[model samples]
Target: MSNKYEEIAQAAIKLFEQKGYHATSVQDIADEVGLQKGSLYHYISSKEELLMKITQQSISGFNRRLEKIIETQVSAKDRLILAIQNHVVSVAANLEMTTVLLREALSLEPEHHTVIKNETDRYLSLWAQIIDEGVKAGEFKPGNSRLIALAILGSCNWVYRWYQEGGKLTPEEIGSYFAHIFIDGIKK
Candidate 1:
């Protein structure tokens, strides 16, 4: 992405994360980026348009990572653990952006919402496929792989809401703990 685009996106994400999407105005983002609101419009047609771009850009990067992780010549269980770890770290690193996605993405215009939803569904499918492979290989327990995938992923997404940057657990610690809980169960 262009530096201008990155600057605009970072500003927008921070604003959206802090003040929320509806509360944050184009002017706020422009001020954050040191651009005139009119000039900001030159780069983005509208605030909603910018939101869509940010959502898509953030997710597409993660999707690329997921694609690579899934393609690794590793056991399905190993891939799932790795995917969980990466998901946790990525969400923690981009907490604000991820929060915007979790909280503000649904408020997009219908077409934009559909685009984001489809991308999300595709990502969920990847998780399901990994779980399915594990089940088939007699690695993970057999049940609803899709539901299990959702539970695992939903837990990760919820992290943005409660995560403190310097809190008790680091991202890797949280990721590993979550993976262990999902893969091995909480019963001791």
Candidate 2:
């Protein structure tokens, strides 16, 4: 994407985070980016399209990083630690986008929603794969990998709701703490 387009997307994310997807207008986004309302369409077809772009970028980033972590030649326990850390750090670094993604994704058109849903499923499956590997290797106790993946992600994804930049724990520290909890919980 061009620098201008990126600027527009960032502006949209900010407005969406502040005023919400349903409440934010095209004019609001245009003003945020110093563009006229009509000119906003040059970069995006509609406000919803912009929402879709922001969400797609967020989920794709998570999947890409997790994919690399999954490919690393390490024990499943170590890999799971890395994955949890990656997720917490990513959520902290991109809080606005993450908030928009979590809170406003359902506002997308059906086709766009389907695209994000698929990407999300792919991401969940990556977590499931790690847990499954740990079970197969006898590192984690045998159980339903899919449900376990959901539980881990449910814990990690909630960081956005209460995260502060200079909070008691850094993102990595929080991530490591979470990793320890999860690893201990699942270990044989």
Candidate 3:
């Protein structure tokens, strides 16, 4: 994407996070990016298109990261730690996009929603695969891998709600803390 397109997407994410998708209009996004509403259409077809782009980009980036971690030859326990840390750090770094995704993703049209859902399911499956590997290797107690994956992702995703830049913990520190909690909870 061009720098201007990136600027527009960032502006849309900020507005969507602050005022919400339903409440935020194309005009609001255009004003945020210092462009006329008509000119904004040159970059995006509609407000929902912008929302879908932001949501897809954030989830796809994390999915790619998780896929790499899953493929590593490390122990499942180590992979899980890395996965948790990656998630927490990603959520913290993209809080505005994360918040917009959590709040407005369902607002997408049905076809768009389905695409996002499939991408999300792939992400969840990667987490479950790590847990399953750990259980099979006697590194973690036997349990529903899918459920455990959801629990870990839920905890990490919620960091966007309270994360502050220059808060008590840096993103990496918070990620490490979450990794420790999950590792201890699941370790055999």
Candidate 4:
């Protein structure tokens, strides 16, 4: 992507995260990028297209990073920890883009909606496999990996609700705390 297009799309993502997808206008994005309303057309076909672009880039980047984690030689338990750590760090680094996916991806057109949803599902499937490995290896208790996967996903994915970069807990700290609770429950 051209630097100009990235700049404009990033601005659009920030606006979407702040005002939400429906509440934001093309003019709002243009102004955010310091572009004339008509000038935005040179880079994007429509506001929805810009939203699609942002969602695609964010999802693609996240998948790429997670794939690298999967290829590593780490054990399943550590891999699961790495997955949560990656998620928290990614969200902290790309809070606006993450928020856009969480809050606005569903409201997009059907085709784009399906595409993003599929990518999201693929991402979750990676974690499920890791959990399955742990269970099979007798590291984790025997149970539904899918449900455990979603529970772990829910914990990490919702970090956007209260995660502040400069807050008391760093993303690594949050990841560690979650990993401890997930890998070992509170019971004796």
Clashing pairs in 4: none
Model 4 residue 146 CA deviation (Å) reads 1.1
How do the residues 96-121 of candidate 2 rate in per-residue lDDT, one tens digit apiece?
A: 99999988999999999999999999
Backbone clash pairs for candidate 1 read none
The TM-score obtained by model 3 is: 0.96
TM-score of 1: 0.95
Best by TM-score: 2
Q: After superposition, how far is residue 111 of candidate 4 from its true place, in Å?
A: 0.9
- Tell me each candidate's TM-score: 0.95, 0.98, 0.96, 0.95
The C-alpha stretches of model 2 lying farther than 4 A from their native spots are: none
What does the lDDT come to for candidate 3? 0.92
Candidates 1 and 4: which is better by lDDT?
A: 1
lDDT at residue 129 of model 4 (Cα atoms): 83
lDDT value, residue 23 of candidate 1 = 96
Candidate 3 lDDT over 1-188, as tens digits, reads 88999999999999999999999999999999899999999999999899999999988999999999998999999999899888888888888998987778999999999999999999999999999999999999999899999999989988988899999899889989988998899889
In each prediction, how many residue pairs overlap at the backbone (N, C-alpha, C within less than 3 A)?
0, 0, 0, 0
Q: Model 4, 67-142: lDDT tens per residue?
A: 8988889777888889889888888888999999888998889999999999988988887888888777777777
The prediction achieving the highest lDDT against the true structure is 2
What is the C-alpha lDDT profile of model 1 across 1-188, one tens digit per residue? 67898899899999999999999999999999999999988788899988999899878877888999999999888898899999999999999988888899988999999999999999999999888888888887778878998999989888888999999999999999999889885111
Candidate 3 segments whose C-alpha is farther than 4 A from its true place = none
If ranked by TM-score, best first, what sequence of candidates would result?
2, 3, 1, 4
